[model samples]
Structures are given as C-alpha cells and as structure tokens.
Target: MGNSTFVFVVFILVYLGMIFGRLPRLALDRTGIVVLGAIALLASGHASLEGGRSGIDVSTILLLFGFMVISAQFRLGGFYSEVSRRIAGLPVSPGALLGAVILVSGVLSALLTNDVVCLAMTPVLGRGCIRRGLNPLPFFLALACAANIGSALTLIGNPQNMLIGQYLNLSFGGYLVFAALPTAVSLLFLQGIVLLLFRGKFLLPMAAKEEPERPFNAWQTAKGGIILCTVVLLFLFTSLPRDLVALGAAGVLLLSRTMASRRTLDTVDWQLLALFLGLFVVNGAFEAAGGLEIMKDGLSRLGMSLASPSRLYGVTTVLSNLVSNVPAVMLLLPLVRDIPGAGYILAVSSTFAGNLLIVGSIANIIVAGEAERMGIPFDWKGHARVGVPVTLASLATGLACMVLI
Candidate 1:
C-alpha cells in the first residue's frame, strides 16, 4: 500500500480503539492510541519529531491545561460537594431540585469544561439524592444533560468550542451573545424532558434526611474560586494568551502552601492531557497527508459549507455521535474556515450531541463511572430514555435558533 494509505489505515484503527475505550488486548487507552499513532507515523518516516512538535497547537494545550488546573482546585477544595449539598437542602419540590441541577450544571459548564463539572459534581449529587431517599437516576441524568447543554453557551464550555474559537478568532462576548439564548432554551427543554420522563418519581415525597454535608476545605475552595474568576476576567478583559493564562493560574494553584504539589498534580488527569497531545499529533499528520484537502473538496462537492448554520449543525451532530465529539471536532476542523457564526454552531452542535447517547460524551462516561461506584445501575437503554429525546429536542431548538437568529 502507499504510505498515505498506510497512514490512513493506522488512523482509522486508532479511532476505533478510542471507540472501544482502549486498544484490544493491550493496557492502552485513548491517549495511548494517539501516542502510538504518532509514533507509527514518525517510525514510517511519514512525519518527523519537529513535525510532531509543530503539529501540536500550544494554545489548545495551554487552555486545556489551565482549565484542568482550575478544575483541580475546585475538586480538591470540596466546592462541588458544597454546591450539591446546598441544592439537596433547598426547600423546593423535587421538581425544583431537578431544575436546580440542570441550572447549576449549565451555568458552571459555561465557565468550566462540561466534563470537569460533571466529574466533580456527579458523586456529590448521587450521594445527596440517595440521602434524601430520592431516586438518584433522574437527578444524575439531569446533571449530565445539563452540563452538555450548558457548555454550549460559551467558547470555554467544551474543547470543541475552544478549537472553534481559536480557529475562527471569535470574540468571547460575540460568541456569548449568539449562544446564550440557545443555551438557556436548551436547558429549559432538558428540564422539561427530565420532569416528564420521571414525573411520577420526582413528585413523590422524600424520607426525612440527615443534614447533608461534606468536608469543606475553605482554603482550597477559595484558591480554586479565585483562580476560576481570574481566568474568566482574563478571557473577558486582557489580551494575554488564553492558554498561558490558564497555565499560569494552574502554576499558582500548584504552589499552594496548604496543598502538596503532588496532590494537586495527582488530581490533574494526566491521561486526558496526554490524549489531547496525542490527538493533536495524529490529526496533524493526517491533515498533512492530503486527507484534509480531500475532505474539504468532498464536503464542498456535497454543498455543505461549514459557514452555513444548518449544514454545520447537521454535520457536527452526526459526526459527534459517530466518533464522539472531541475526535469528531478534530476531524472536522480542517473543513471549517473563519466565518461569522461558525464558532457558535460548532460549540452548540458538538456539545448538544453529547446528550444523544450514553457513549456520546466523556461527561456521560464520568457520570456512569460514579454511578457504578455508588452501586447505582446505569445502562445505555436507561440513559437513552432521557438522553435521546432531550438531545433531539435541544438540537432542534439550537439549530432553529442558529437558522432563525
């Protein structure tokens, strides 16, 4: 086979590995697949070390790293736990709790990445529901769906948004103006779906519950809170590089005298960071092999311009479900050019698609993991009952907004 064909085959295998959650019969994960692909390209003289290094987008890496660090601070400080507890204690009805979960998830997701918010919030939410003698399933589902929907509101909400923002050079405020209404509407749609699907259960009275609480690390929470606020302000006001801002915040958090650097580092998902680096290199090489040009031409032939709202939304939704949103975004990035509303479309469609299936997003997987740890049964069928309809409804709303406004 030609070298191009060989590289293409390897790329397909790597993505397949990602789909199965790891490489077959190997103690390797998605990050490993990406790293292996990059190595294969280099070994076969398809790419060089300099090429690999150049392939990695430092801005994306820095932004991801900064968010991870900021997220770590929240995780360590027990802020998520506090928020969960406060929600649990609200005197409102179970329906209100459902609304609160979706609202909080959406709001926090716009600031922090959806996956991080879900990872930090799920366990606390699960435990809180159980303590209240409430079925944790609906609440947990709300958390997952809300995070996915809410992350669509801003450029920093998900990795796909960051890529779109950087690629399109979108202004933070402009993206928000275009996305905020759609995001809000999507959250309401999600809430309505959750209430209807689980109405019988959500309306039932809860048993008397112990006062819900978790160990609160005030110092850690404060540190995380400050860093998160600073990062937002930086994004809004200063012209400093986004990634550098995130990395610098992470550095400050890591140097905390109260928390060991090792502990802070341990909280960081090194695997996730590696996955980004690996995908960067692999996708970079794929783009260099004329695959991207072929894709652009094919898409153009199909009359699907990435700049078109309806087309972009349709393509992003299908691709997100097909390969998972992150990888799908990486594949589609080459086809997207600087356009007025491309960032909003990319962020909205990619994120909302995550709500379509159990396997659709990393946040869903994290929620599932937490469910398993808590001895809660969570399966694809169960999730799809809420997931599929909510996803479709939100997607329709988002797409309509994109097309109409």
Candidate 2:
C-alpha cells in the first residue's frame, strides 16, 4: 500500500478507537491511539516530528494543561465540598435543591470546565442527596445536564468552546450575547424535567448521616482560589495568551509548600492530554491529506458552510455526540471560517449536545466515574432517561436563540 494510504488507515483506526472509548480494553487508551498514529505517520514517511508538532495546537494544549492545574487546586482546596455543603444547607424543598444544583452547575461550569465542575460537585451532591432522602440519580443527572447546558453560555465553559473561540477569534462578551438566553431557558427546562420525573423519589425518607461536617483542605483551597482568580482576570482583562496565562497559574499552584508537587501533578488527567495530542496528530494528518478540503467542498455542494448558523449548529450537535464534543470540534474546525456570531453557535451546540448521552461529553464521564467510586449506580440507561429528552429540549432552545440573536 502507498504511504498515504497507510497513514489514512492508521488515522481511521485512531478515530475508531475514540468512538469505542478505547481499543476494546486492550490497555491502549485514546492517547495511545494518537501517539501510535503519529509514530505510524513518521515510520511510513508520511509526516515528521516537526510536521506532527506543527499540526498540534500548542496554544490549545497549554491552555488545557493550565486549566487542569487550576482545577486540581480547587479539587484539593475543598471549595467544591464547601459549596455543596452550603447548597445542601439551604432551607428549601427537594425541588429547590434540584434548582440549586442546576444553577450552581451552570454557573460553575461557565467558569471552570464542565468536566471539572462535575468532578468536584458530583460526590458531594450525591452524598448530600442521599442523606436528604432524595434519590441521588436525579440530582446527579441535573448536575451533568446543567453543567453541559451552562458551559454553552461562555467561551471558556468547555474545551470545545475554548477551541472555537480561540480559533475563530470570537470576543468573550460577544459569544455570551448569543448564548446566554438559550442557556438560561435550558436551565429552567432542566429544572422542570427533574422535578417532574423524580419528584416522588426525591421526597423519599432521609438516611442517617455518616459525616455531618464536610471535610476539606484549607491550604489547597486557598491555592486553587488564587490561581483560578488570577487565570480568570488574565483571560478577561489582560492581553496575555490564554494558554500562557493558564499554564503560568498552574505552575504557581504546583510550587506550593503545602501539597506534594507530585501528588498535585498526578491529579492532572494525562490521558486526556494524550487524547488531545493523538487526535490533533490524527486530524492534522487528515487535513494534510486534503481530506478536510474535500469535506468542505462536499459541505459546500450541499449548500452548507460553517458560517451558516443553523448548519453549523446541526453539524456540531451531530458530530459532538458521534466522536465526543472536543474531538468532534477539532475535526470540524477547519471547515469553519471566522464569521460573526459563529463561535457562539459552535459553543452552544457542541456543549448542549453533550447532554445527549452518558458518553457524549467528558463532563458526564467524570460525574459517572466519581459516582461509581462512591458506590452510586449511574449506568447508561439511567443517564439516557434524563439525557435524551433534556438534550433535545436544550438543543432546540439553543437553535432558536441562535436564530433570534
């Protein structure tokens, strides 16, 4: 076979691996697939280290790494625990707790990535709901759905939004104008769904509390707070590259005297980083092979351009569910050109689409992982019950917002 054909075959395998969540439990993960693809490209003389590196967006990697550090700081700090405790402490009905979960999930997701928000909040909320005589599943699903919906409201809400905003050069505030309304409506819709579907379950008798007081690390919390604030300010006010600003904050958090640097660094999900790198190399190769151009032409022939709001929305939603949002965005990005309000469409659709399935977004997976660790049975069917309808409702609302705004 020709070198290009071999490269293409390896690339196909890599994506297939992504689709199946791994290479069928073969000890290889997404990152391994990506790295293997890069090696294959080089071995077959289809590309070089220079080409591969050039293809990977250093800015995107830097930004993601930095945010991971920032998120790690929060995880150690007990901020998430504290917040969950405060929310649980509210003198409200079971319904109100559901609303608070959705609200907090959305807001926190807008600041931190949705996945991190879920990672931090899931256990706390889950335990709280169980103690409150509430079925934890509804609340957990709310957290996942709300986070996905809320992340759509801002450029930094999720990784895909960040990539689209950075690549398309969408202003921070501009994207918000396009997404805020849809997100607001979607949150309300989510609240209603939980209240209707799980009302009886939520009102079940309370269980005896195991630990009345939530445990947290003060020093870790302080470090995380400082770094997060610094990164947000830099992203909002300063001219520094977003990636550099985030990485700098991460570096500072890692140098703390309280926590072991290795421990803190270990919390960073290197597999996710690997997934990004592998997919970047694989997608880059496809682009280099003129595959992307062909896609763009085919899209054009169908009277679709990424610049068209509805078309972009449909594409992002479909692709997000297919390959997961982040990787899907990476694949489709080249077809999109800089256009007014396009970033918002991409962000809204890709993020909201995550609510489509348990595996549709990393945030959902993070919540599921944490829930499993806590002995909660959060299976795909359980998730799909809430996920499917909520996703459809939210996507329709988002599409309407795009049209109106």
Candidate 3:
C-alpha cells in the first residue's frame, strides 16, 4: 500500500483506541496506541525519526508540564480537598450545595486545568456527600459538568484551549473578552439544569463513611496559590511568553525546602504528557502524508467550510465526542487555524461538548472513576441524564454569545 494509506490505517487504529479507551484483548490504552502509531509510521519509512522529533511542540509540552506541576503543588498541599470539605460543611440545603459545587468546581477549573480539578475534587465531594447522608451522584455529575464548562473560561483552563491560543497567537485578554460571557452563562445554565434535575434528593442527609485525607499544609498551599496568582497576572498584563512564565512559576515551586521535588512531581500526570507528545508526532505525520488536504476537499464539496466559525463549532462538538477532544482539535486545527475568532469558537465549543456523555472528556472519566472507586454507582446512564441537557443548554449559550460577539 502507498505511504498515505499506511498512515491512514495507523490513524484509524489510534483513534479507535481513543474511543474505546483501550484496544480489546491488547493491554494497550490510548497513550500506548498513539506511541505505537508513531513508531509504526517511522518504521514504515513514511516519516523519519528526525521529522517525528521536530513535530513534537516543545512549548505546548512545557506549558502543560508547568501547569501540571502547579496543579500537583495544590494537590499535595491539600488545597482542592480542603476547599471541597469546607464547601460541604456549609449549613445549606442540597440545592444550595449543588450551586456551591458548581461554583467552586467551575471557578477552580477556570483557573486551573479541568482534569486536575476533577481529579482532586471528585473523591472529596463523593465522600463528603456520603458522610452528610446525601446522594453522591448529583454532586459528582455537577463536578464533572461544571469543570468542563468552567475550563472554557480562560486560555489555560484546558489543553485544547492552550493549543488553540498558542497556535493562533490569541491574546490572553482578547480571548477572555469573548469567552468570559459565554462561560458565565453556561455555568448558570449548568447550575440550573443540575439543580432542577436533582432537586430534593440533595436534601436527604444520611451518614456513610469517610476517607482519610492528606493533612492540609498551610505553607505549601500558600506557596502554590501565590505562584498561581503571579502566573495569572503575568499572562494577563505582560507581553512575556506564557510558556516561559508558566515554566518559571513551576521552577519556583520546585525549589521547596520542605516538600521533596519527587513528591510534587509524582503528582504530575506524566501519562497525559506522553499522550500529547505521541499525538503530536502521529498527527504530524498524518498531515505530512496529505490526508488532511484530501479530507478538507471532500468536506468542501459537501458545502462544509471549516473556516467558518459556526461550521467549525458544529464539527468540533461532534468530532470531540467521536475521538475525544484533543485529537479532534488536532484534526481540525489545519482547517480553522487562519479563521478570525476561530480560537474562541473552537475553545468554547470543544470544551463544552465534553458534557454530552461520560466518555466525551477526560474530566468526566476521572470524576466517574473516582466515584466508582469510592463505592458510588456512577453509570453512563446517570451521567447522560444530566449531561445531555446541560450540554445542549451550555452549547446554546455559547452559540448565542459567539453570534453576539
């Protein structure tokens, strides 16, 4: 077969792994699949080893790694867990609690990465619900949905947004100007949909069990918070490169006198970094093989101009669920890279599209997995009941905001 056809085969296999979460009967997960695909392309002589190395976007990797370290600092410091514990301790009804969960998860997610927020908050919220005699399902769903919506609020909120911002050279303040309103409206829509769906159930308090949590470290938490604030200010006010500023912040955190760098680094999601690297190579080779141009022409013939913001929004939302958001964004980037306002459209649409189903985004998967481990039954059906409406409403809000802008 021709080189292009061989690359296409590998791409399809890799995406299948993404959709299934793993390859059947093969202990290979999504990360392993992409790594294998990159290897295959190199071996087939379709892409050289040097070309593959150059394809990996080091700046995106650095920025992602730096943010992961910052997130790790918060996780190790017990910041996320403590915040959730405090919110659950409030003397409020279940509906009020839902609102609090949405607000906290959303706001934190808007500041940090959504996956990290979900990873650190899921167990705390779940156990807190069980301890307070409230059902954990609604709160779990809220954490997942709200995190997805909230992550769209800023450029650094999630990986795909970061890619869009960096690739498009979008101004941090400029993108936020367009994204903030839709994100706020979506958050409100998420809160309302979750509240209306799980009303009264949140009020039934029944005590369950509690999991031992990490000791809250005031100093470490303070350090991470300070660094986070500085990084944000640098991103918003200064003209310095965001990746360099973020790496500097991560470096500062790595210099702790008490906490071992190993401990903080251990909290970093290395597998995710690997997945990004592998996809960069695999997708890069696929693009070099001329697959994207062929697909674009086919779509153009179908009257689908991906350069259009609205059309890009629709395709992004659908493709995100099909192969997960990161890869979908990678596939769509060449099509929309030059379109004005495409960054905001892609960021808001793909990130919010994650709420459509449990398998739609990594944040949802993390929340669901954490809940299941805590003995809470969080099935896809339960997620879809809330996910479907919240996704539709949030996307509607996003579309209206995009139109107004």
For residue 289, model 1's alpha carbon misses the true position, in angstroms, by 1.0
**Candidate 2 Cα RMSD after full superposition onto the native fold (Å):** 2.5
The lDDT ranking, best first, is 3, 1, 2
Per-residue CA lDDT of model 2 for 166-253, tens digit only, reads 7776777667777889999999999988788876777545453465443688877876777777777676677777877778888888
Give candidate 1's root-mean-square deviation (CA, Å).
2.5
Candidate 3 ranges beyond 4 A from true positions = 49-53, 203-207
TM-score of each: 0.93, 0.91, 0.97
Model 1 residue pairs with clashes: none
| Each prediction's number of clashing residue pairs | 0, 3, 1
Question: Candidate 1: where are CA atoms >4 Å away?
Answer: 22-27, 51-53, 203-214, 301-303
Error of 3 at 217 (Å): 0.8
Q: What is the lDDT of residue 331 in candidate 3?
A: 81
Candidate 1 or 2, higher lDDT? 1
Off by over 4 Å in 2: 51-53, 205-214, 301-305, 338-340, 373-375
Lowest summed lDDT window (length 10), candidate 1: 203-212
User: Where does candidate 2 have its weakest 10-residue lDDT segment?
Assistant: 205-214
Cα lDDT for residue 240, candidate 1: 76
Tell me the alpha-carbon RMSD of every candidate: 2.5, 2.5, 1.5
lDDT of 3 by residue, 1-405 (tens): 987889899988998888787887899988899888888887877766573443677778888889999999999999998998998888888888888999999999988999999998888777777778888888899999999999998989999888888877889988888889988888888888887887767754555666688778999999999999999999999999889989999999999889999998988889888888888888888888888898889998999997777688789888999888988888888777777777778888999999998878999999989988877788999999999898888888888887777
